[model samples]
Target: MDDFDALSAMAERCFPGLETWNRDQIESQLKVFPEGQICIEIDGKLAASSSSLIMEYDAGLEWHNWKAISDSGYIRNHKPKGDTLYGIEMMVDPEFRGMKLSRRMYDARKDLCRRKNLSQIIIGGRIPGYHKHADKMSAREYIDSVLEKHNYDPVLTAQLSNGFIVRGLTPNYLPADGESCGYATYSAWTNLEYVAGAKRRFHHVIEPIRICVVQYQLRTIRKFEEFHQQCEFFMDTASDYKCDFVLFPELFTTQLLSLPSVDASRPGQAARQLAAFTPQYLDIFTEMAVKYNINVIGGSQFVVENDTLYNVAYLFRRDGSIGKQYKIHITPSERKWWGVSPGKKVEVFDTDCGPIAIQICYDIEFPELTRIATQKGAQIVFVPFNTDTRHGYLRVRYCAQARCIENHLYVAISGCTGNLPFVENSDIHYAQSGIFTPADAEFARDAIADECNPNVETLIIHDLDFEQLRRHRDQGSVQNWNDRKTDMYRVVYQEDEKTFEV
Candidate 1:
């Protein structure tokens, strides 16, 4: 029944004369708005059909005919992000009419409206059986009778029972239908389950969010108890500020090399040995996230998995759920000196604040990786970097700024500030943690949400209003997210199943 011939035939049979759409017209409708055209089949044959398109509610405000709203049932004025779902047409096979097939179709349309988060559904109900009552009463009187249940109409009665309220009567809505001298009724069904606030905010959610970026000083850990206390200190400080998310620097676990059993002079050997403490590191973050009631990006760690050593970040949720994202791009020194294996995927972490991604150190240098993450619904990209010099630190900082501008999303950078003199690779660290926004009038004059002093051990926290960002995306002077040349070029990713693994 999805074929053009079958669909056109069904329409011709259900609605004769000018009311029926031709094969070419049905094909055109499907091509333009495929989601609007829906068909229900029984016994492998089309039993009923319903079509709809998202449109502004104002267009459905008056007593306009179906052709005025939809392009003669083709739905030319469809808007993908509109707040209302406009019903174009609904037809049930004559043989299946009494089986309540039309009701099922209406239910399906309502389900679609809910799934799309539309505020309401509007339709121009045809008075097919009104021609007989035209002389006794007008279109408005006929509709009122249907609403009061004193009289029932084939189409209008069912609409009333399905929770629709008549707004007004339209004249000459369908010229071919001699019913009541060609008149229709404008009806609307408000979604009872519609979410109250944010869903209606320009189709973008408006939430209050706060993030904390840590410029942590590296220290020698004689025991796991000392490491636990340090983590609690950081978490409590950010939690006291009511931060929704707290981010830490990359390879912060290198402090574990201070254990007497691990060699502090050899970085690679120390990192490999710290693998044994990975479980404890994760447990502490998990506990902290739940205790502080916030999302925590516990920085990146070097772990040996399946005989391959790679850098990975751990995200702990307030609900005690843990997720992981591996560092896809590896630095030359990581390959040469550490013999570290690069990760294969970029993963997006979901939090109460929003969807976020973590790109460890050198991974932030690659624009495509962060772009892919943002395309997957990441509103923020957290970079956990461990740089040994001012030049290396600047590389991460500048690239982070560019990533925020290019992706048009918030970027938080946290780095290790102090050095672990006893540890080899952990020595001579430099950093200035900061949260950055897209450089626009809606943001700060400097594009910096919050920042810590360079080479200092401190936490930088700032509140981000989601509504402001949502508005900026629409009215920004340079809308980077919406100004992409998608028709000419697209961002395509190659295969790497390991990169997205939790």
Candidate 2:
């Protein structure tokens, strides 16, 4: 409480032309839940602060406004045994806006929540940008637009990007404020680490995850054993580097069509014959993953499921478990000649490091797929593409980079480099496999972590820092994931009932 005057002055600077918290309110907050009240000092001056209290939170059971929940800023309604940490106020001085002080305060609150064994952190985030759009759209529409990233709110966007999900909207949340038009977004960030009846524990550290992207060379092969031997070589190299995940190029298995027994003239028949290798393909990668103790993205292959041919990518985990995602978008040539059908679902697979998604070839061109995956808690995306021309390869490359920027997640893309003379449609290939990161100071300067030389048969290995990504989403120069306008538009994946709104 000794710094009450400085804090009061800071609040006045943060919320000008509005009511600032008085000395009594500040004292009540510190007296009630001192651990929840946080302040940051820069050069001997208070730069930012956040105040919160513990309470039992049930959205369906309570309809609360800012004044009522916060006891008119006194926080006298604070409950000691509550399961939720309710954020009443967060203020950052205008002079220190871009320093990410707000993010630090949020981290502090999360630490407090874990130490106290709290279930979640709830906040009534103000949509100050709503007032500007009020004449054009309803409050709900404006909020949805922001959720979908169609619009940006100074306060709400940052909160959402920092791992908060919208619960609902609160009307007349703050009548005194004209900026939000007396409205607020009810958001919650659940603590996945929270354990019931457990004591305080130290935060877990997230180490950097290494990825090895193979610019695979396609060549005519004599038999299945030859292809198996080639795969084992790359797996051995990736494991030697202690990489967590190894990615292969899409349709690299199509080299099997180059065999003498296969009829290369009949495109459809050749693809169906390649599908015959699906069982063997799965076996080799599964064996490789377990043998090398590394996760493997076995690239993409044509598989016949229930009489339909679809492009599928497999994730072979080191634990001997396998996950698969079918290619969702089929290209014109694929539909016309290959007779391939599009996939129905977008899925995220769990790894020891974190959750990840796979998009094959043409599927990477669709931004909605990556957005849907990111919303499902995926931290990285692996793209395995095979393009016959440089233009086709650029389409996949540009789209993959865009996904990384728009979703603020790492994207590692690998593609076929050599040619298959005996195969019809797979005769020529072109690619420059690359690992892309978000365009931010915390990441690589060009957003390219590592890339194999164009049209080269080699691999690029790089370590991606998931902790840096977490911090970037919370405090980057731009929070793309958070500033979406969900009230305006959304991308819905019907399979898992997953939705990404902007």
Candidate 3:
């Protein structure tokens, strides 16, 4: 007991300005700050001590509450949170001075900051006295060395350290001996990114963004070469309209796939009739694009490649060259139309506007296909439709909207507008297409109104900014989608709907 008292007296001799608290006061403070303070007992006596508050605000002292107002918006999260301050108290017995118990106290405080999410620790660093103090080595230098060894950056200078910078200065008015050189405050904010990155951070985005978008109206539907003499009129109107690229519903001009007359005997005849439209359409689209500086989507139609038919869409760029004339991602439904081999790989191509992706009617229904496009950084996805019935039309539009939300991309779908008569019912379905955002997906869908009210086929055109998409990815709510923990539960698909490949 006497040795502990002697050690406390010795520590006071070392940190001369430290308050020489009576044992009763120290015990009282320690009781109140049980978790906040650490004490080293030597020979049944407290020899060294440290204490701190590990919170965003000054939760320890009443005087520190004033800082909370200064940093109101920060904790409120309205403004940028400034560096957090940890006022750590350290006292070491002079007998243990050679062992450097101050260094140990400083290390414990740093660990507190790390575990509690505090970025910095502020020190009421020693202020020089009027007369030279007898202490040869500075407690500041020792703390700096320890902090440096632990990889803490020196951001604040207190008193007179070259590497240290001052955050705040207090007026000199010491109640003890009435001595007061302004108390200099120094801080060391924690660096956590390096630690997190070293641990290998990964982002698991399960659902892709669904982008709903559309292109402008096209004007060349009347000149389908059905009347050869109308070619002059068609070209004139196309040029007058300044058509860069006009999307015609696939197979509409020739009525190819939906034709009742198509049979196995003369599949070659159907191929010839379709090829007849492309050369003329492509030439006009290519010329108009170069002249007017615009792009045109030649909607999905049968392409005869090596005697095997493939559903394809051509994107003609204004450079008189083409971009991403990708084969449509085919579904079983398309097999009946042209007996097309499904396009084997996903495709996204660069254009002046953005990376444009094309997915045919049925392809838009699959989320992974759209996810593949989103992951590849596709901004605008072009959807072209040919319908057999209204049975699946609503499903198609909903899937397109889902794609826009999940992928955060734009979708432009051109639907087959004209009526096709089959069976006893003249069933025709129209997809109301538009662009959707994370904020605006529901609004966009709500704006569609009832199509049964006899509205013209919807054509929505909007310049989708890439920045807004980035912001949505950064801070937007996941709407519970991102909460999916795919790593934990593994659900096996039934045989009818297995999505994984063997």
Model 1 clash pairs are 131-180, 344-499, 345-499
Q: Estimate the lDDT of model 1.
A: 0.81
What digit string (tens of lDDT, one per residue) describes model 2 on residues 17-57? 77888888988888888888888776578888999998886
Give the alpha-carbon lDDT of every model.
0.81, 0.87, 0.48
TM for every model, in the order presented, reads 0.59, 0.60, 0.45
Q: Write the per-residue lDDT of candidate 1 for residues 441-497, one digit (tens) a residue.
A: 889999999899999889888888877877777788887877888887677776553
Q: Roughly what TM-score does model 2 have, to 2 decimal places?
A: 0.60
Clash number for every model?
Answer: 3, 25, 25
Ranking by TM-score: 2, 1, 3
RMSD of each: 17.1, 22.1, 24.5
Worst 10 residues of 1 by lDDT: 493-502
lDDT of 3 by residue, 300-343 (tens): 55666687776677777755677544454555544554466766
lDDT of 2: 0.87
The better-scoring model by TM-score among 2 and 3 is 2
lDDT score of residue 230 within candidate 3: 28
lDDT of 2 at 321: 93
